[model samples]
Target: MNRRRTPRSASAEELLSTLQHLTARARQEVGLHQARVELAQALQGKMLPAALPSFPGIRTAARYAPARDGLDIGGDWYDAFLLPDGALGLAIGDVQGHDVEAAAFMGQIRIAMRAVASTAADPGEVMARTNDLILSMDSSLFATSSFFRLDPATRELAGARAGHVAGVWATADGRSGITSDAGGLPLGIETGQRYPVTRRTLDVDGVFVLLTDGVIEGPSLSIGDGLEEVRRLVSAHTGATAEELADRVLRAAVLTGHEDDAAVLVLCHEVTPRDHG
Candidate 1:
């Protein structure tokens, strides 16, 4: 005797209903993920200082460019804070990696460096202390940083570098120069090694530009080419504000295919005489 076969179970209406439910769930999940990513980006934006402090007879502008990977929150950072004696503390640094971990490490080093710089008049001593602290904390972590103290009154800037790139100084007469030191190893490398500090006299209305290697180490261009590009862009926009010049440089870098994370801080000394009238 042949057994009667049972009819297949799922109905057209049932299949349609199931597909609709799955489609709705997928749309909901996509929306949630989008919101999460947007929130993360907002948080990263907040990590940077809301506004750079204003100083007497000085103008400052800065720009931070996240990488195209959307995880652009890297170890690169710039900070301007007040010292106890009213001298402004200016610094730019880049940790070895480029992720959330690097950003967190940058925050820690930034705070410690600020503290050391506030009390120590010598840029070398401040960097040495910061280096020692970073070294003593961990054996595997490393970073490169440059610390600078700008005296608006004297138009002088004293700075120390720990394997970071030398900043460029754009003179009022359209000449560009680099502030290069003998250079010391990056932080967390060798303890007790002294980093030398260099001093430069900035001209009135001159601009100093500090940047991370990300701005120079692109896949298409060599470091020298990047520097030349930066010089060209800055020289063309001599009348632009420090912030505007920084923005132009970074935009040009991206247009030229500098794919890594980028950061720039510019300080311009404006000639504003006291009101003796």
Candidate 2:
């Protein structure tokens, strides 16, 4: 009778060894995920402006918030720099992913924009040149951006957009509306795309608010609704300083259970209300 003998149980040391190996592997995976998250965070930290460029008669404040509970980093970025003609240049953009690559790409795009804008005279030319540079890299990713050249003394803004969401602006007398500028396709879409530019001057004590889509759009919300919401926020809080207004806008976005990264840049031409006399 060739009956199968009962299988012997694994020895205690053997079982312990197997468990130790599994535990090591589990911990290794956890550590790897954490390391990747940290690396993305670092990339994002370096990509953001350490301090927004300060100029006379221009009070600027910017804020950036991560998505997914900080488990990942998205490609939202804001930059303020000095243009060649002494105009203050400002930009807000969102790259198309949420990972280390996105963060790195965002950093490169901001640097490229600053470099290109410093020498370019027209907002349209700046966008075209930047589009070409981004395509030269052969990256498959795309990005949406809003660029502005502002004369601090006049608060005259020459703006361009590349498939970005509309920004909201508020005047000292409490009038607020979408920036409603002409726009082009997002960068990396095609070669030689020309972006249209618009020019507007902020009234004394006027404010212009720029932000990523993350601030406005939610799963159930449309872009138009989000824009209106931001406009209301801006109009309702004109009394707030640039910093306070930035916080208010960002706080509203956060309260809506936002699932993406958000960046807000608030520019106030003058803090004091315009004299009606």
Best by TM-score: 2
- lDDT string, candidate 1, 3-75, tens digits: 9999989999999999999999999998986875676467557666778876765777788877665454677
Per-residue C-alpha lDDT of model 2 across residues 74-170, encoded as one tens digit per residue? 9999988887778899999999988778888998899999999988978888988999999999998999999999986776789899999889988
> lDDT, candidate 1, residue 201?
70
Q: Tell me the RMSD of model 2 versus the true structure.
A: 3.9
Query: Of the candidates shown, which would achieve the greatest lDDT relative to the real structure?
Result: 2
lDDT for every model? 0.77, 0.86
| 51: Cα error in model 2, Å | 0.7
